[model samples]
Target: MTGNLTRAEQKQQTRNNIMAAALKKMSEDKGFSSLGLREVTKEAGIAPASFYRHFSNMEELGLALVSEAEDALQAILLDAKALEEKGEDIVASSVQVCMQHFRDNGPLFRVLAREATGNSPLIRRRIQRCLMNLNHQLAEIIELEMRRRHRKITNPLYIAEAISTLVFNLGIASADLPYAKQKEAEKRLAHHIRIIYWGAEAMANSQHLSRNIMLS
Candidate 1:
């Protein structure tokens, strides 16, 4: 019997526990390549055979961990979207919200970060695909901000890619930092974001101005 859940809920709970165990195991300075199914099942307090009930293999479990990390922080985007609608500095707001999530969900961030740089080639590529999906989602928001402000970006995707690079890279790097350095990293990231914001503006405005100058 698993907790207070019915049979079906217990089954789902077991699956969640397995994933959590994997995350806990991988939380240290390690990656998925070092995780073992037996170790994860033991930590989850389930039979190793039961792991197959939820995941076909270790790679499947690893993929689920990546997806779980994404699901965990979807709220940060919701808050950032709301702030953008309010015409706030979404870049700065998102940095704070994200680092807060990093603090709250350090293990999940560690899972994503280490897996991204893990020794498993397949896992590395899959994680890159996941990050690219997040990049596109961010691009959509950038387009929304542009339209809402009546601003033009000749290539919103380009700007979004740049911002995504900063956020994703700095996120992992910052997470791996000592707590003392996190605040400074946040400030540094904020400066990087402001530069991105201004560069995106210039991408459209300055280019348009140059066009006008050449026309005259």
Candidate 2:
């Protein structure tokens, strides 16, 4: 299997190995900031010098991890959109999907949540940027749904921001909970998401009523 790989493929495989090693080391107990280059290289079965061949420094490697996470989240967003188009209850379905992801990739996301608020300014910014991009993507989805349903909302972006913030905080809170507790947390999340939509619809109705009164 090793000999058949092209040089580029081998190099890419090594890079992936290094990334996997770093991610495996990260957890709620061991954050990205505390990881040592030597340990990661040892786990990857590469010399410490070989680490520099793939990453300029640990910060660059941290950014690579964040990039991979962004790809995963983007995939989730696409799945949510598909569910919406199918007339599924997107809020409940999305919460379940996100919680399942947390269960499967708990350490990876725990690292991201920690590093976003960690002492490293560069890592914080990169993770935040990824989240902001998700926020925008979600806003676009909300706006399109509003248009499809002929509903008037003041700003879908604000709704999206509220949903994103709520989900981020709640998802982190629930990630490590026991199965029953996690289900309760997810129920709360789904309820809050519905409330946000309901509140937006009420606000839109009020604005419409105000306009009618003014025209009269």
Candidate 3:
């Protein structure tokens, strides 16, 4: 099947295979920090030495997985944000899409959520970096929306960090619930996000009013 692909494509395929194998191992109650190279290589159907070609070591592989999760999450959040321009409820839209993504890519997301506080400091730091990246991206999006509405917030990054933390925490929680309960989780998440936005807007208005009063 890989015969028709170019050399670069084949290497990418092997790299994907290695990552998949690692995910599979992690899904079975094993943390990435505890996984051995030989076990992962065997699962990937590649020789142990071949692993070095893709990743320097297990830590590097774990970082790759984190990178993939970061990209997937950014895409999901951006897609939900885009819906807000179309009159869709961004909170509900984001929850529904994010939950669906968790369902579709459970292992990938589960690893990310678990490793965020796992025993490995390297993995934990990488996860923190991923969340920080998401926070900044989300802040930019929120800033644009605020500008569009002629609104001002003291710091969009704070709001972004709050929203990102809440959504990710709730999203991970929802992943463990059954389908019916997941729906309830979605409602809770959407409600929480709305409240955050509402408070932010109220503060911005109050600030605006205070400035006008002083000017008057």
Candidate that scores best on TM-score: 2
- For model 2, the superposed segments whose C-alpha errors exceed 4 Å read 1-4
Tens-digit lDDT track for model 1 on 1-216?
A: 346669899888889899888887877555688888899999999999988999999998888877777775566667777888888878767787877777777787678777787877777887788777777777788889878878877687677788767776677677767877988888988899878877778778989999999999
Q: Give per-residue CA lDDT, model 2, range 1-216, as digits (tens).
A: 999999999999999999999988885277788999999999999999999989999999999998888887787789889877876667867889977876766666766778999878999999989898899999998887777777778688899899988877787778889999999999999999989998999999999999999999
Residue 3 shift from truth in candidate 1, angstroms: 5.3
Per-residue lDDT of model 3, residues 1-216, tens digit only = 889999999999999999999999998989887899999999999999999999998889998999888878877867867876665656656678888877767788878888997888998998998888888888887777777767767689999999888877777767878989999988888888888988998898899899999999
Question: TM-scores of all models?
Answer: 0.85, 0.88, 0.84
Instruction: State how far residue 108 of model 3 sits from its true place (Å).
Output: 2.1
In model 1, what lDDT does residue 19 have?
85
lDDT ranking, best first: 2, 3, 1
Question: Ten-residue segment with the worst summed lDDT in candidate 1?
Answer: 71-80
lDDT of 1: 0.80
Whole-structure CA lDDT of model 3:
0.85
What is the C-alpha local distance difference test score of each model? 0.80, 0.86, 0.85
| Candidate 1: residue 78 Cα off by (Å) | 2.1
